[model samples]
Target: MNKKILFVDDEENVLSSFKRNLRREFSITTAPGGHEGLEIIKNQGPFAVVVSDMQMPKMKGSEFLAEVKKISPDSSRILLTGYANIENAIDAVNHGSIFRFLTKPCSNEALISALHEAIRQNQLLTGEKELLEKTLKNSINVLTEILGMVNPAAFGRANRVKRYVNQIARLLKLNNIWKLDMAAMLSQIGFVTLPNHILEKVYHQEELSAKERNMLAEHPEIGAQLIKQIPRLEDVSQIIRNQNTDFSEHQKISTPLAPVQKFIVLSSQILKVVLGFDEMIFRGISKPSAMSILKRDKSKYNPKVVDLLEHVQISEKERMQKTLALAQLKSNMLTNQNIISLQGKMLVAKDTELTDPLIQRLKSYDVSVGVQQPIKIFV
Candidate 1:
């Protein structure tokens, strides 16, 4: 409901006249030219409507409005020009995405009407954006919840990798990183398709058969296929698909790419590095040793992302291991030793983070067939 209006023109009298006439009807701000207008937009902007004179010194309205769109896409733009510049105004409307244009000598009433319509358009755009964000969040929540229930190990691994990705993103000072976060969280979604026994073997670092290894290799593709079905997640899917790809593969793209394409490549590289690092940790590799190993395989990982690992502070609390009874276990605690049943089978893998579903499953197994206790835990 931000009905704030910004008027950009080179003439001082026109700006003064706009404030004099429209001050009572709207929240108005004026800038002398495109440069000043841009500064205003950056500092005190997201104005509901931005009206600019089509012919201005140094920067044309079309150029100014185009920059405004990049800075504040929700702000509806309007071009004001003389009748002689009608063609240019039309071009601006098409290219600059101006909401509308007003010819010279426009009546005050006509200007007011355009302002109202522009405000309405802004509201619609903002409302739609909010709705889409809410929907996307809810969708991701549902998917993660399902993953937690279907495959607790994979779900826990995804959450852990997401934390690492967040740490790396923070170290890099990345902006607007929700897409990267989403890619991290859903990177292992393909595990949902694999049998629980296969996942257990993978988590336990047990030797895999040729078939099992092949199945595991196909996971990224399966995950990508499942995720690409969702709207607006094509980039995320691509990131997931490439999460296992080597850094050398990303370097193969010699041609220039769009900004989004570059972001996807960077995101995939981050996921790849984090996933590999997490695997080493899960296998009982020390942080320093894991980093050294990653450094040794220079072509396998993005060195920049791997370098950020040195800064990520591993929690000291997770290292203090203790033994607890099966009944005493709680969520979020890391398992220091594999939980084995009385029958000599591994119930849970070492280094696995406990989730609610995992805890419930262990409790149920303990009841049906006793689990050896006390279980070793990080807490």
Candidate 2:
């Protein structure tokens, strides 16, 4: 497919000339002024290149291209000026990071060459971004799989907490949901270093000695350290580190946090609320009673997050539920009853949120030990 290019100028004739000259060579879009060009870039963009005239009214070319750099950094920019002074060239190059600075009445051949080069640069930028994202996703999956195998109880809690985190995120209209989701999934990774009996006792709501409790308290930091080793996961690691921290403690800190850090703090608080509630359910407490207990210590959580969790939980209960064969189980269904193996071992706890990985693990268990039919799940 031909790469899309946008041309911006105050002069209607110049825009028309650009369209007439480059319409066949590329997918050409023209804007009469900088404001319209910006709007087009926002609404119909990811354009491979944006060419703007420097002398446009209302907004100058350098200023417009600077905004373009903020909104679409990978889209190569070019500044075309009829009066090309050294100052204009410097501003265009420094502020807009323009790939090319050309004089007005630029030859068609020069413009075409610049556009093609810009397209090549855009391809490189987008290609690297895609590859990095894919690699990160694959690495996360592999790590989570290892965690599940090594510590199913902690892994199950992670899955449950992730569901609540997602609901709270949606209710808050958050943009960085993947960070929240990943933080939830890997929040318990630190527990892998502890003995299996400690994890089992914790999962069963058994009391621990002071030393063991202190060791458990350090799991978040351990998890953060483990996750921080991965590239581009610094924010996620921070969220995991702070999952047990009270929101008020964060506010008491002297240094103000960045926007993303504030998000991590909020996400951490939400995870704490959900994990607390899940613990209550595991101990056989009724949902209403558990909610009341959580509400009594409202200062421990973000009020908005707790309220959203209640709302999401209520709405989720209204979904249709079914009892199906193990072979019919699907991802994203909540377990209505504990799935026990033939040997009377709990395969998955009630109220646990199902995921594809968990489902695949169950299938493997079936192949190895054979599962009974008719698993109860809430869709």
Estimate, for each residue in 217-297, the C-alpha lDDT of model 2 and write its tens digit: 999999999999998999899889988887678667788877666777788888888878777866778887877787778
Question: Per-residue lDDT tens digits of candidate 1, residues 77-148?
Answer: 999999999999888888988899999988999999999999999999999988987898779867876776
How close is each model in CA RMSD to the real structure? 4.5, 4.1
Those runs of model 2 whose alpha carbons end farther than 4 Å from true positions after fitting are 1-71, 81-83, 87-98, 107-109, 171-173, 253-266, 273-298, 310-320, 328-334, 351-360, 367-374
Distance from true location, Cα of 376 in model 2, Å: 2.3
lDDT of 1: 0.87
- The most accurate candidate by lDDT is 1
- For all candidates, the clash counts are 0, 0
TM-scores, one per candidate: 0.77, 0.77
Judge candidate 2 against the unseen true structure and give its global Cα lDDT, from 0 to 1: 0.82
* TM-score result, candidate 1: 0.77
